[model samples]
Target: MSPYSHDFETLEDSLFAMNIMILISMALPLLNVLGYFLR
Candidate 1:
């Protein structure tokens, strides 16, 4: 019923996607370092 609800939903989706990408980017390097140390 709110006028701005649709825009807010889209913004939240984009923010969620950005967070996922950032987490994957951070995790990849951490995994590489762990693999090196474990090997």
Candidate 2:
């Protein structure tokens, strides 16, 4: 593959990883809040 495609692939992978991390972080806090309210 071309260097440009390789760079884009790496960048896309990184962005996807970052998005997953953010979602996990958000979900944990939201769950904690719900648990506190329920309990």
Best by lDDT: 2
For each candidate, give its TM-score against the true structure.
0.82, 0.78
Report the alpha-carbon TM-score of model 2 versus the true structure: 0.78
State in Å the error of residue 24, model 2.
0.7
Error of 1 at 10 (Å): 0.8
**How far out, in Å, is residue 38 in model 2?**
3.9
lDDT of 2 by residue, 1-39 (tens): 799999999999999999999999999999999999999
In Å, residue 1's CA in model 2 sits off its true spot by 1.4
lDDT by residue (1-39, candidate 1, tens digit) is: 686998899999999999999999999999999999999
TM-score, candidate 1, is: 0.82
* lDDT on C-alpha atoms for all candidate structures: 0.97, 0.98
lDDT, residue 21, model 2: 99
Residue 8 in candidate 1, Cα distance off native in Å: 0.4
Off by over 4 Å in 1: none
RMSD of each: 1.2, 1.1
